[model samples]
Target: MGFAVAIVMCALLIASTTESQHNEAILRARIVTLTAENQRNGVALHARLAACEGGPADLARSRAASALLTPEQRAQHLAANGPQGFDVCARMESADRAVLETLK
Candidate 1:
Protein backbone atom coordinates (compact mmCIF):
# COMPACT_ATOMS: atom_id res chain seq x y z
CA MET A 1 0.00 0.00 0.00
CA GLY A 2 2.79 2.43 0.93
CA PHE A 3 4.64 1.59 -2.26
CA ALA A 4 1.50 2.17 -4.32
CA VAL A 5 1.01 5.57 -2.71
CA ALA A 6 4.64 6.50 -3.39
CA ILE A 7 4.26 5.56 -7.04
CA VAL A 8 1.12 7.62 -7.34
CA MET A 9 2.82 10.59 -5.74
CA CYS A 10 5.77 10.34 -8.12
CA ALA A 11 3.46 10.22 -11.10
CA LEU A 12 1.61 13.27 -9.90
CA LEU A 13 4.89 15.15 -9.44
CA ILE A 14 6.05 14.25 -12.92
CA ALA A 15 2.72 15.30 -14.40
CA SER A 16 2.84 18.63 -12.61
CA THR A 17 6.38 19.32 -13.76
CA THR A 18 5.47 18.45 -17.35
CA GLU A 19 2.48 20.78 -17.26
CA SER A 20 4.60 23.59 -15.82
CA GLN A 21 7.22 23.12 -18.51
CA HIS A 22 4.59 23.19 -21.23
CA ASN A 23 3.13 26.41 -19.87
CA GLU A 24 6.61 27.91 -19.65
CA ALA A 25 7.29 27.00 -23.26
CA ILE A 26 4.10 28.73 -24.39
CA LEU A 27 4.93 31.85 -22.42
CA ARG A 28 8.46 31.95 -23.83
CA ALA A 29 7.12 31.71 -27.37
CA ARG A 30 4.72 34.56 -26.64
CA ILE A 31 7.55 36.65 -25.26
CA VAL A 32 9.59 36.09 -28.39
CA THR A 33 6.70 37.13 -30.62
CA LEU A 34 6.01 40.26 -28.58
CA THR A 35 9.67 41.21 -28.52
CA ALA A 36 9.92 40.96 -32.28
CA GLU A 37 6.80 43.06 -32.75
CA ASN A 38 8.11 45.65 -30.33
CA GLN A 39 11.41 45.85 -32.19
CA ARG A 40 9.61 46.40 -35.46
CA ASN A 41 7.50 49.12 -33.86
CA GLY A 42 10.57 50.79 -32.44
CA VAL A 43 12.18 50.84 -35.86
CA ALA A 44 9.08 52.29 -37.46
CA LEU A 45 8.75 54.94 -34.79
CA HIS A 46 12.37 55.85 -35.11
CA ALA A 47 12.00 56.33 -38.82
CA ARG A 48 8.90 58.42 -38.39
CA LEU A 49 10.50 60.58 -35.75
CA ALA A 50 13.64 60.98 -37.83
CA ALA A 51 11.54 62.16 -40.75
CA CYS A 52 9.75 64.63 -38.42
CA GLU A 53 6.48 62.89 -39.19
CA GLY A 54 5.64 61.53 -35.77
CA GLY A 55 3.26 63.89 -34.04
CA PRO A 56 1.22 64.19 -30.87
CA ALA A 57 -0.88 61.19 -31.90
CA ASP A 58 2.24 59.07 -32.14
CA LEU A 59 3.47 60.26 -28.78
CA ALA A 60 0.11 59.58 -27.14
CA ARG A 61 -0.03 56.09 -28.60
CA SER A 62 3.51 55.41 -27.49
CA ARG A 63 2.75 56.64 -23.98
CA ALA A 64 -0.26 54.37 -23.78
CA ALA A 65 1.73 51.38 -24.95
CA SER A 66 4.53 52.22 -22.57
CA ALA A 67 2.10 52.35 -19.68
CA LEU A 68 1.19 48.71 -20.32
CA LEU A 69 4.38 47.53 -18.65
CA THR A 70 4.27 47.34 -14.88
CA PRO A 71 7.17 48.56 -12.80
CA GLU A 72 8.07 44.96 -12.01
CA GLN A 73 8.07 44.11 -15.73
CA ARG A 74 10.27 47.09 -16.44
CA ALA A 75 12.76 45.94 -13.85
CA GLN A 76 12.69 42.39 -15.14
CA HIS A 77 13.26 43.53 -18.73
CA LEU A 78 16.24 45.62 -17.74
CA ALA A 79 17.66 42.85 -15.60
CA ALA A 80 17.23 40.20 -18.27
CA ASN A 81 18.83 42.16 -21.11
CA GLY A 82 21.58 43.77 -19.09
CA PRO A 83 22.77 47.23 -20.18
CA GLN A 84 21.45 46.87 -23.74
CA GLY A 85 17.93 46.30 -22.50
CA PHE A 86 18.02 49.74 -20.91
CA ASP A 87 17.65 51.37 -24.33
CA VAL A 88 14.20 49.90 -24.94
CA CYS A 89 13.09 50.32 -21.34
CA ALA A 90 14.36 53.86 -21.38
CA ARG A 91 12.29 54.68 -24.43
CA MET A 92 9.14 53.26 -22.84
CA GLU A 93 9.88 54.70 -19.43
CA SER A 94 10.63 58.12 -20.80
CA ALA A 95 7.48 58.20 -22.89
CA ASP A 96 5.39 57.29 -19.85
CA ARG A 97 7.34 59.71 -17.68
CA ALA A 98 6.68 62.55 -20.08
CA VAL A 99 2.95 61.97 -19.86
CA LEU A 100 3.12 61.89 -16.07
CA GLU A 101 5.09 65.11 -15.97
CA THR A 102 2.51 66.86 -18.09
CA LEU A 103 -0.24 65.88 -15.67
CA LYS A 104 1.77 67.25 -12.75
Candidate 2:
Protein backbone atom coordinates (compact mmCIF):
# COMPACT_ATOMS: atom_id res chain seq x y z
CA MET A 1 0.00 0.00 0.00
CA GLY A 2 2.82 2.42 0.86
CA PHE A 3 4.59 1.64 -2.42
CA ALA A 4 1.40 2.17 -4.38
CA VAL A 5 0.84 5.53 -2.68
CA ALA A 6 4.44 6.60 -3.46
CA ILE A 7 4.01 5.65 -7.13
CA VAL A 8 0.78 7.57 -7.37
CA MET A 9 2.39 10.60 -5.77
CA CYS A 10 5.29 10.46 -8.22
CA ALA A 11 2.88 10.31 -11.15
CA LEU A 12 0.95 13.29 -9.84
CA LEU A 13 4.17 15.28 -9.42
CA ILE A 14 5.22 14.54 -12.99
CA ALA A 15 1.76 15.47 -14.29
CA SER A 16 1.85 18.77 -12.40
CA THR A 17 5.25 19.68 -13.81
CA THR A 18 4.15 18.77 -17.32
CA GLU A 19 1.02 20.89 -17.04
CA SER A 20 3.02 23.85 -15.74
CA GLN A 21 5.48 23.60 -18.64
CA HIS A 22 2.62 23.44 -21.15
CA ASN A 23 1.02 26.55 -19.65
CA GLU A 24 4.29 28.46 -19.78
CA ALA A 25 4.76 27.52 -23.43
CA ILE A 26 1.22 28.67 -24.23
CA LEU A 27 1.83 32.02 -22.50
CA ARG A 28 5.09 32.52 -24.40
CA ALA A 29 3.39 31.79 -27.72
CA ARG A 30 0.73 34.34 -26.84
CA ILE A 31 3.41 36.92 -26.09
CA VAL A 32 4.96 36.28 -29.48
CA THR A 33 1.57 36.73 -31.18
CA LEU A 34 0.97 39.94 -29.26
CA THR A 35 4.40 41.23 -30.27
CA ALA A 36 3.59 40.66 -33.94
CA GLU A 37 0.23 42.36 -33.52
CA ASN A 38 1.85 45.31 -31.81
CA GLN A 39 4.36 45.71 -34.65
CA ARG A 40 1.53 45.60 -37.19
CA ASN A 41 -0.55 48.25 -35.40
CA GLY A 42 2.17 50.43 -33.88
CA VAL A 43 2.04 53.05 -36.56
CA ALA A 44 -1.66 53.67 -36.09
CA LEU A 45 -1.33 53.67 -32.31
CA HIS A 46 1.42 56.28 -32.47
CA ALA A 47 -0.55 58.44 -34.88
CA ARG A 48 -3.54 58.43 -32.56
CA LEU A 49 -1.42 59.36 -29.58
CA ALA A 50 0.24 62.11 -31.59
CA ALA A 51 -3.15 63.43 -32.67
CA CYS A 52 -3.97 63.92 -29.01
CA GLU A 53 -1.53 66.83 -29.41
CA GLY A 54 -1.46 68.96 -26.27
CA GLY A 55 -4.47 67.42 -24.64
CA PRO A 56 -3.43 68.01 -21.03
CA ALA A 57 -5.86 65.40 -19.77
CA ASP A 58 -4.36 62.67 -21.92
CA LEU A 59 -0.84 63.84 -21.13
CA ALA A 60 -1.59 63.99 -17.42
CA ARG A 61 -3.10 60.52 -17.42
CA SER A 62 -0.03 59.15 -19.16
CA ARG A 63 2.27 60.89 -16.70
CA ALA A 64 0.34 59.75 -13.64
CA ALA A 65 0.31 56.15 -14.82
CA SER A 66 4.05 56.24 -15.50
CA ALA A 67 4.66 57.60 -12.03
CA LEU A 68 2.69 54.75 -10.47
CA LEU A 69 4.86 51.96 -11.89
CA THR A 70 8.00 50.76 -10.13
CA PRO A 71 10.74 49.28 -12.33
CA GLU A 72 10.09 45.72 -11.14
CA GLN A 73 6.33 46.09 -11.44
CA ARG A 74 6.81 47.41 -14.96
CA ALA A 75 8.94 44.40 -15.90
CA GLN A 76 6.45 41.92 -14.40
CA HIS A 77 3.53 43.63 -16.09
CA LEU A 78 5.35 43.55 -19.44
CA ALA A 79 6.00 39.82 -19.10
CA ALA A 80 2.43 38.97 -18.09
CA ASN A 81 0.36 41.48 -20.08
CA GLY A 82 2.50 41.44 -23.24
CA PRO A 83 1.52 44.15 -25.78
CA GLN A 84 -2.00 44.61 -24.53
CA GLY A 85 -0.99 46.74 -21.55
CA PHE A 86 2.42 47.81 -22.86
CA ASP A 87 2.10 49.02 -26.43
CA VAL A 88 5.12 51.32 -26.06
CA CYS A 89 7.99 48.87 -26.48
CA ALA A 90 10.82 51.24 -27.30
CA ARG A 91 13.44 49.01 -25.69
CA MET A 92 17.11 48.57 -26.59
CA GLU A 93 18.19 46.08 -29.24
CA SER A 94 20.54 44.26 -26.87
CA ALA A 95 17.78 43.62 -24.34
CA ASP A 96 15.27 42.71 -27.02
CA ARG A 97 17.80 40.34 -28.55
CA ALA A 98 18.36 38.76 -25.15
CA VAL A 99 14.63 38.19 -24.77
CA LEU A 100 14.41 36.66 -28.24
CA GLU A 101 17.28 34.33 -27.40
CA THR A 102 15.74 33.33 -24.10
CA LEU A 103 12.35 32.76 -25.66
CA LYS A 104 13.84 30.58 -28.34
lDDT against the true structure, per candidate, is: 0.63, 0.60
State which candidate has the highest TM-score: 1
The number of the candidate with the highest lDDT is 1
Alpha-carbon RMSD to native, per candidate: 14.2, 14.8
Task: Please write out the lDDT profile of model 2 over residues 26-95, one tens digit for every residue.
Answer: 9999999999987876665444333322245455654465457754454554456343324444343246
Give the worst 10-residue stretch by lDDT in candidate 1.
46-55
Q: Alpha carbon lDDT of residue 41, candidate 2?
A: 65
Runs in model 2 lying further than 4 Å from the true structure: 47-104
lDDT of 1 by residue, 4-48 (tens): 999999999999999999999999999999899879976765543
With a 3 Å backbone cut-off (N, CA, C), the pairs that clash in candidate 1 are none
Off-target runs (Cα >4 Å) in candidate 1 are 53-104
For each candidate, give its TM-score against the true structure.
0.49, 0.43
